[model samples]
Target chain A: MDVQTWTYLLVIVTFALYIGIAIWSRASSTKDFYVAGGGVSPLANGMATAADWMSAASFISMAGIIAFAGYDGSVYLMGWTGGYVLLALLLAPYLRKFGRFTVPDFIGERYYSKTARIVAVCCALLVSFTYVAGQMRGVGVVFSRFLEVDINTGVVIGMVIVLFYAVLGGMKGITYTQVAQYCVLIFAFMVPAIFISIQMTGNPVPQVGMGATLADGSGTYLLDKLDGLSTELGFAAYTDGTKNMMDVFCITLALMVGTAGLPHVIVRFFTVRRVRDARKSAGLALLFIAILYTTAPAVSVFAKTNLLKTVSGQPYAEMPAWFKNWEKTGLLVFEDKNGDGLIQYVSGPDNELIVDRDIMVLANPEIAALPAWVIALVAAGGLAAALSTAAGLLLVISSAISHDLIKNVLKPEITEKQELWLARGAATIAVVVAGYFGINPPDFVAAVVALAFGLAAASFFPAILLGIFYKRMNSKGAVSGMVVGISLMLFYMLKFKFGLFDGGKEAVDALEADWWWGISPEGFGTLAMVANFATALLVNALTPPPPEHIQNLVEDIRTPEGAPPAGSH
Target chain B: MQLPTEFCRLSGPARMFTFSGHTNPDNMDQPTRQEHATRYWNANLRIMAVLLAIWFAVSFGAGILLREWLDQFRIGGFGLGFWFAQQGSIYVFVLLIFVYVYLMNRLDAKFRFDR
Candidate 1:
């Protein structure tokens, strides 16, 4: 069968499974909507969290990022996975014991201030919105290429599907669907990798194949071959580091802190049966995530090797059909810099072709000449990943608005049914807004996602940590810390990214060279996070201590004794 | 670890909290509850401190700050630093969580807090 038919069938089957799960798991109450009635088993919640956490970026972009950046790309692998340790150890158990439905709920009650709750809600919305935009962009890319639809139409269709599942099932439906998605995406990701690995290295395991010698008995390791190929093409050796060590350190730190602080990931712990289960679920999540995270680098190695061997010195007329197909999408550009018909996939000022990093993962199947079914599977996996994450983020956004803002803060007297309705309405709006950004992507969606991580690392992470670990942390300190941290991050990002408030192009140009102490915008959040911690500590020390009952509340949350039954709320 | 032993001893009849005149209700007191709470909280902190130190050492230490030094050695085709950053650190993180779970469960069981 043709690739198009396979994609259509696979995508439809996956979508039908997700919709069916949504219908079956339709939530009936606000608690059910927000925390899956707090009944998800640790193993199931772990799978759901994995699906929610990976996103389009993990499935489609991470290997691609690693492929081009090489050694510097290890930051992503360590930074993202290390955060789960922080989550399991520092946050999840205590938060689950607190038995809150949402992150803002913890902040509001713990600090005993509406202002703090509102601040948390804003941060959660900003972080989640930024994240969902990337997922939407992923959906668009998959749809545009696999289904032969326009990007806008693809995004709209994705929005509709997410809206249906998210609005109907809320957290309950999204959780089960994510379990299915995890299976689909992991299977899709590993199959191609295994196929390519065996073909190249006589090893079925991609991870092992990454270090194995070539099947042709070259006696040279795969990395050694890649390093040789890269240098020959005027690129840095594939196994050597090129980025500043300080930047790498700071970016990795920021991402670890940011991952632990993301609201969507944290809220997943709230669904488990007990504090014990929360801890167990986090471990399970790490295991599931590592399954893909570890494989990603191997995939990167395979794709990079395949691309280098195939098209590097080939004449333009002899370029593969897949190469021409990708070129028509404008993600690949050829300039024929030397006025020679032969293509040079070198890295230089005069390199002939400019290939977007994102093309690495999307083009992996074609580059390897994999079967039509495998390509279709990749498309389905990408969509599943994007949609699952989009649903998860939309749930966080809607819960922040309806549960945190409306029900908890604004109108405490609203009925539970009314709150559920509001949640659904908020989800629909979130999907529409996300779809808009997907159609008119502001930048490389993954870079925008890095900004989201920065924002979370700076703002919520400190506040949440202090809330759990430091009893002296008061409303004034937590609120101010969030405001200062998030504002500083936003200012730095806007100045560097959108050139916001820099009059015309020249001022922006001047500021481009003005990054503080040579830290890239992506790495600046670590500094902002430090500033937030200092500001909170200083502010807390100066202010009158929180009232007696607030201290009691803090102490109560810290202790594991007498935890409310998980689903009681 | 000491917290669990202390909890096993303290949550006996002498330290129990009661809203009514039930078993050992007369022994229930605010200071006892406060003491139990303080011990539990401190033990939790001790565990966190130890675990976080290891977390930091593995990721930020071996993976980043000391990466270049470590890269002088290679495991298979991977530099020690590269392996830690891409694969080793993640495995350590998973191991850390399970250790935490085991320790916390012991604490919970000792305190009779496990449901």
Candidate 2:
């Protein structure tokens, strides 16, 4: 079938599956809404978490980043997956054992202060909001391209689908739908990778295909060839660790910690029954996520290799129809720089014949003359990824507002039904705000995602870990640490993100586009995390410890128990 | 790394508290609190060190440093180093979390410390 026909059928089928899942898993009680009654199987929760964790950015933008970053992009590969280790090891089970509905609950009660909870709430909202914006933008791009609809219409449709499932089902609906999405996205992601891998190296597995020798028995290593090709076309060495090593290290560290701290990912652990289950679920979740993450770079390499082969030396006007199609969307564009019809897709220090880097992955199958159905499947996959993450993030915000702020703090006596309405209302409002931001994403989706991670790292990560492992951490410490940490990272990011805090985006947009002190915005969170740790420590030392009951609760959460008999509650 | 085995000797809820119980008098004493805090911090530090070590070895050691040497070999068209940096490190990271989950479970059981 043609791409248009495929796009229509896939979107209809996908939407129907999602709505059906939502109806089947409609959440009634507050417990059902928030934690899915804390009864999700480890395997089920793993699937859901994988879907939640791998956002539109992962499916659509990561390959694009790697396509360009080349060897230096290892930071993304290491930093992103490496964060899950921190999550499963240091954060997940402990939080699960605590059995709270949200991250702010642990922070608020542990510190025994509303200020700490409020600080945490703000930080959570900020990270989640920024993240949701990226997802919305992803949805918009997919709709605009495949459906031939306006980008805003695509975003609204995605929001509606997510709202239908998320409002009725809450975590329960999102979880199951996400499982389906995980399958679609991973299948969508891997099929193309495998195809390209086979075409390039006679290998069906993408991971193997990435490092395999160049076709035509070129004798040089695949990376060496890429490096040669890149530099030859006036780009940096493909495999050199040429960045400011310190900044790269920091960014990677920040992302690892930030990922661990994200509330949506952490709350997934709570869906499992026991601490042991939580651990198992985390491991499984990572494995499922890895099915795609591991394949992303391979896809990047394959796509890059294909482009260099197909278009690098060819005349721009003679470029394939796919090129013109993507350019029409403005996702990819060329200006005949120096009046030359040849288009060079290299990173230049100053020249501005710009192409939106995200176009590489979105246009991969098309670039390779793959079947139109694959392109349609990609369109569907992008929508799934963005919508799933957006729903998950929206739920986090609404849950925080209703569960932590409204019920837990402001009115502890609120009924479950009332709280449920408030949560839904909060979720709906969050979607509207996110849609607005989606209309004008502050930057490329991946860059914005990195900034969200940085904020999350600075604010929540140290607090959550400390609450689990440190008895002395008080409210004063947590409040101060999160406030300072998030603000510091925000100041740095805002300076470079838009014309916001310091020099405008243009000042940083020049060829000297390195982040402050050479720390790319993606990696700056590590420095902020350290700052959070130190500040929390110092303030905790100065402040008094929480009440006796609070300490006892902390200790109680540390111990695991045998599973209680089912249906006993 | 070996932990302070005797750290869990205290009975009842004491095992739940990571450090000396909260310092509310009609509360656990300072010496006990200091001991537990020190022990808890040590265990957490040990775990972090181990995980961090593995992390660096995979990404920096295998991915960047030894990538050249490993690249002499190939899997399909991909060099071993390229695989590790792009794909292998992530696989190892997933394994690391499971390993950590396993190790910490044992530690918690031994210390009577996990919930």
Candidate 3:
């Protein structure tokens, strides 16, 4: 079949599967809707979480980032995956033990304070919304490429599809569909990697190909080739770090913690049967995730090397058909600013000419001269990754507003049906908003993905950890701490990101050199977290512990099955 | 972190050694809350230490501090230091999650604290 025919058939088949899952697994009650009846198998939950966790950034952007940043991009890989460890070991089992529906629910009950719950809710919405934006953008890219529609139209299509599937099946439907998505995306990622590895290094395995010796039997290494080319083009060594080291350290750490603290991810644990099951499921999830993470670097290296061989030193008129196509959208722009007739797409201030790093991954198969269909499969895979993560994030958004905010605060007596409806409606609304923001993403989509790590770290991790482990923590402490942590981190990020307060990139970039105590905004989250930790501690120490009634409730949550109830609490 | 000795003692299975109103029937007042606090705090601290070590090793150790020295070794087109700073480190990270979960399960069982 032709590429378009194959892509259309695949898209239809995938959609049919999603709708079938939604119809077959429609939620009938709050439990079915929220936590999939709390009986999802460990392997299945592992698959679903893998789908939900590997966002558009992971599929489309990570390889590009890795290819370009070289060694520095390790931060993305480690930071993103490391958070899972923190989640599985430090948070998931305990949160599952708490038997709560949302992170805010845990906060509310743990601190015995409604205000604290609401603060957690707001933070959840903020982080999830920012995350969903990237996913929406990914979805648009996929649709525009495969469905042959404008990006905005593609976003609308994705938004509608998500609203239909997510609203119908709730967590139950999403879980199964995510498993299917995992299969599709991983296959899509690996096929091209395997093909490229064989073509380049006489090896079928991508990981092996990544470390393979040069084909010419020269003493020079493959990475050495990349380093020489990039340096000659005025770019930093592909294997060197150039960003502010402190910021990189702080951001990477924050992302790791944030991954652990994200409520949407934590809630996946509740779908499992027992505490031990939660831990086991977390391991399974990582195993599924590692299949892709381990292969991404191989893809990055292969794609980058391919692009340079195809494009560099070629005259503008002789540029390949793919280059001409990409340049039309400015995604692969050719300045010819120096009237050089040749495209030089490198980092600024030195007139460098190299491919954009992100393009290295997204446009890899095509760059490698693979068949058109493999490229199309990649388009579909990227969409699946982005869409799954977007759906997960949007669920968190609606839950925070509808379930945590409206039901918990404004109308505590609202019927379960009404709350569920609100959650569904809130989810739909969030997708629409995300679709809009996605069209014109903020300047630093890459950095924003990273910033989410910072936000997740500073705001939620401390409160969630304290609530689960520090039983003496008071409501006042958790509330003030989250508010202060979230707001302070947001202000710092916005200052650098938007430059609304700083006026220009020049001013904000200057801050990297001239900031107080030499703390870059990315790393400033560590300080925000410290502030959160201190404020929570000071407030908890000053305030009275929960009333015996509340204390007893805490005890009840800690007891395993068959243990005596703590009474009235 | 010289917490009270009562914490170490409370590490075992439920027992009746009261220090409150009258340990008449159920050891209800024998400091379950205090014991929970100490155990939870200790477990969290332990997890923090291990995860932070892995995080630093991947990011700081591989990516920055030892990158130049380690770049002498090559795998495919990537140097040992370069790959660690990027690919190897990420693989280790995903592995770390599985290791942590495996370890935490045992820790929970040992502490008699699965709840």
Candidate 4:
């Protein structure tokens, strides 16, 4: 079959499966809507969490980013996966024992203050919206490539599809559908990787192929070859990085802390049956996520080798059809500098081509000359990744509004049905807003989405950690710390990223020599998070301790005994 | 760090205590329960501190801070530091999660908190 027909068929099949799950498991009450009735087994919840956590960035763009970024990309690989260790150890089980429907519920009850809940809700909405915007843009990229539709139309279709499942099924439907998505996405990711690995290194396993010698009877290892080629082209060796070590350290720390603090991911543990199950499911989720995370580095090495061999010093007119196809998308731009018809994929400031890292994964199958169906499967996988995460994020956004803002804060007297409708309305509005951002992305959507982790890291991680670990941490400390943390991060980002609030006409780049301790804006969140911890500690020391009952509540959550059964809420 | 003898002496009863709260209510009073809870919480904190230290040593230490020193060694076809940054550390992380799960479950059982 043709690539287009195969893509449509696979995408349609997956959408139908999602819709079926939604209809079959449509939520009947707030219990089902929020925590899948709290009956999801550890293994099943683990699979769903894997799907929810590995967004389009992980499935579609991470390898691509790694392919070009060389050793610096390890920050993402370690940072993203390492956070699960923190999640499993410190957060998931305790939060589950707290027995709340949403993150804000835990914050509000623990701090015994309405304002704390409002602050948490605001942070959750801010982080999830930033994240969902990237997912929407990811959907548009896949649809535009496969369905041959404009990116705007693709965003609308993605919005409509997400609105259907999220409005109808809530967390229950999304959970089960995400399990199916995990299978589709992991299969799609691994098949091409295996094929490319075998073609390059005579090893079917991409992980092994990453270190194995090339199949061309050369004794040199694949990485050595890549390192040589990169340096030959004026780029840093693929085995080493040009990034400042401290910046890499800071970015990795921010990403890991942010991952642990993300509301959508943390809430996934609430769906499992018991406190022990929450811990077990996190381990399982990490295992599932590691399947893709470990494979991504291997895929990165393979794609980088293939691209360097295919493009560098090659005549532009003789370039593969995939090159031209990606060129039209504006992700790959080539100009024959030096008036020669040859292409040069070099790394100096005057390089003739600007290749967006995102295209490396999307264009991988074609670059390797894979068959039509595999390419189609990649499209389906990308959509599954985007939709699963988008649905998960939208649920968090809606719950923050309906459960936190309206039900708890604004109208405690509202009926269950009214709350459900409000959740649906909030979700629909979120979808529309995310779609608008997808169509007109604020810069590259991925970079904007990376800010979500920074925001979550700076604002939520310290507050949540102190709430659980320190009995004396008051609402005053948490609220003030979050405000300060988020403000510092936002000020830095606005100044560095958007170039906003510059003193009346004198343009200043934050990356210049005056950059704080040589840390990029992307890495500044680590500093803000540290600031939050210090401020919260200082404030807690200065103020009166939390009341006796609240201290007892903290101790109660510390132990698993006398806990209410799941779904009791 | 405390000597092994001291560590073992301090942890013996905490490890051996298995009074089920429901089965033997009189044997475990509020004070005893609170004491056991404190010890268990302390033990949990100690275990977490050790594991997190190892976690930091592997990722930030070998992978970043001491990377240049570690790069003097190579495993298979990879620099030891690069391998840790990309592959070795992730494997260790997963192993740590499971290890934590196993130890925590045992701790809960010792305290009769396991369901």
Q: Write the per-residue lDDT of candidate 3 for residues A1-569, one digit (tens) a residue.
A: 76667777777777787778778988776667677778888999999999999988888888888887777777777677777777775687667777756788878878777777877887887788778888888888777766678998888888887888788877887888898899989999999999888877667988877777656667555666777888877778877877666666776777678788777788888888777777788888888887888888778877887777776766788977777766655577665666777756555754535455556665777767788778778877887898788877877787788877888799988988888788788877887888888888876775676677678788889988877667687788878888888888888887765565878655766555555466666667777888889998998899888677666665555533322211101
- Give the DockQ of candidate 2: 0.38
Instruction: Please provide TM-scores, in order, for all candidate models, with all chains considered together.
Output: 0.95, 0.89, 0.89, 0.95
Q: Please, what are the lDDT tens digits per residue for candidate 2 over residues B1-115?
A: 4334343334445544434333333333323444644455567569868987998798877886687798788675456786788888898898887787787777766544554
Per-residue lDDT of model 4, residues A1-569, tens digit only:
98899999999999999888889989888878888888889999999999999999999889998988888999999999899988987898889898878888888888899999999999999899889999999999999988999988999999998898888889998999999999999999999999999999999988878988999998889999999999999998998887899999999999999999999999998887778888889988988998899899999998989998999998998998999999988989998778788887888865788888887788888999999999999999999999999999999999999999999999999999999888889988988998899999977466668888899999988988898899889988888899899999998877777667765223555345666898887888899999999888888888889999999888878887656755465
Reference-based lDDT, residue A483, model 2: 83
Candidate 1 per-residue C-alpha lDDT over B43-66 given as tens digits, one digit per residue, 9 for 90 to 100:
778988999999999888998888
Clashing pairs in 3: A211-B75, A211-B76, A212-B76, A223-B77, A344-A353
Put down candidate 3 lDDT per residue, B22-77, tens digits, no spaces.
23354433445456545655675687688768766876787667778888876656
* CA deviation > 4 Å runs, candidate 3: A216-219, A338-340, A343-357, A439-447, A504-507, A549-569, B1-59, B72-78, B104-115
At residue A527, candidate 4 shows an lDDT of 96
Residue pairs of candidate 1 with colliding backbone atoms: none
* DockQ-based ranking: 1, 4, 3, 2
Worst 10 residues of 3 chain A by lDDT: A560-569
Off by over 4 Å in 1: A444-446, A501-512, A565-569, B1-31
TM-score of chain B of 2: 0.65
User: What TM-scores does chain A show, candidate by candidate in order?
Assistant: 0.97, 0.94, 0.93, 0.97
Provide the lDDT at A259 for model 2: 84
Residues A200-254, model 2: lDDT tens digits: 7777987776777766676665666777887887887766557776666686778
Q: What lDDT score belongs to each candidate, Candidate 1 first? A: 0.87, 0.78, 0.75, 0.87
